[model samples]
Target: MQIEGSVAFVTGANRGLGRAFVQALQSRGATKVYAGVRNPDRLTLSGVVPMRFDLTEPASIAAAAQHCRDVTLLINNAALGKVNVGALDTAFIDLSREMFETNFYGTVRSCQAFAPAIVGNRPSAIMNVLSDATWFARPMVSAYSATKSAAWSYTNALRVELRETDTQVVGLHVGFIDTDMARDIDAVKSSPDFVAHVALDGLARGDEEVLADEQSRLVKRTLSTEDGYYLDPPPLV
Candidate 1:
């Protein structure tokens, strides 16, 4: 669907990749952009409406969907990546559960809550900000990868379910983004603005899946190889 004049709603719009998404939408001529954040007061972007939204809270998501009924585009950019995800030891269960709540479950909640509005507004779309980790596993981020894997699969299913409607479903895969989420990670990273623009471009082009960076592209290309990148993947950097 065309982004110009589209009404878009983005979750976790307070900062990082979510902030980039909001900016890109504005530059692309979106008529109205809703920034979904737990604390609307923290939003600094002007001319954009802010709504209280917390992925872990079903009530907040439902309320945002009800209030932002004009939203023709839904961008699931909110996620929990850093906290407790780098370890899978004694506290693995707790850490993994928390990440899943905000990553997988939260995204699913956003999709479910906003489907009615998106469908009613035909010519709409849903873009889920996914990760390259969906296809590989790393010890430090195994739990995190698991969450993204679940989300990635769900995105595919969602696309199939929405095939008959005018609403499009797209999944964006990328390596570490140069955002606060990867503030300390010592690895090559894609610029948030760059990835955000690529994602919007893919959405406009009606692509069901978009690889935002070379690392992601390479990783996907090796998925079917004899060694299979997942078995012992090369360094993304």
Candidate 2:
């Protein structure tokens, strides 16, 4: 789990939290950092090597695995979200499916493709970027919340499955982050640099789950309470 001398492959590394991950890994002394992006031309980071791939494309996922055979840290950070304005509208269903395609199934695909390379590599780790949405619901982002919930479940299962191999499976959950993904949201957002720092710190310490911000930590603490936080919708401002 030590970042020093490790090889890391991070998806969605062109921007946002993914970019932060690439920078943090390099700063922590990773020997090689493979930055995965749909368009390799977009990657401007100096130290990281860019690899072209899309989460929704099976071939791309397979190719990345084949190409980054030495990667010991697999970070699944790519995600998409489309607003679902109305539950009764067909567009809502379509949006939900789209979100799941990237957030849920894409994560599974990445894990499946990279697990073999990381299994026998002692001190290796897999980090899945999840969200506070996994534990709470909001009308404006219902579809996103659902997809994150599914991903959270998958991360838990993957952790247990990879237990024998000693490959650390870390789930990173946070509320809104100060990234393009939350550009329009007015709520307080954590800086991507700070979030990435906490996530990498958790990985080094072999923590199973990292709640990156106050909101995420709050939501996690309420998960086991009777009539949990999810029971009531937050009042709209």
Candidate 2 per-residue C-alpha lDDT over 106-153 given as tens digits, one digit per residue, 9 for 90 to 100? 999999999998985766999999998898878788889899999999
Supply candidate 1's per-residue lDDT for 16: 87
lDDT value, candidate 1, whole model: 0.91
The residue-level lDDT of candidate 1 at 215 comes to 84
In candidate 1, what are the lDDT values of residues 22-120, reduced to their tens digit? Answer: 999999999999999999987898879999999999999999999998999999999998534345477777778999999999999999999999999
Instruction: List pairs with backbone clashes in candidate 2.
Output: none
Which ranges of candidate 1 are over 4 A from the true structure? Answer: 83-88, 234-237
lDDT of 1 at 63: 94
Worst 10 residues of 1 by lDDT: 82-91
Q: Tell me the alpha-carbon RMSD of every candidate.
A: 1.6, 1.2
Candidate 1 contains a number of clashing pairs equal to 0
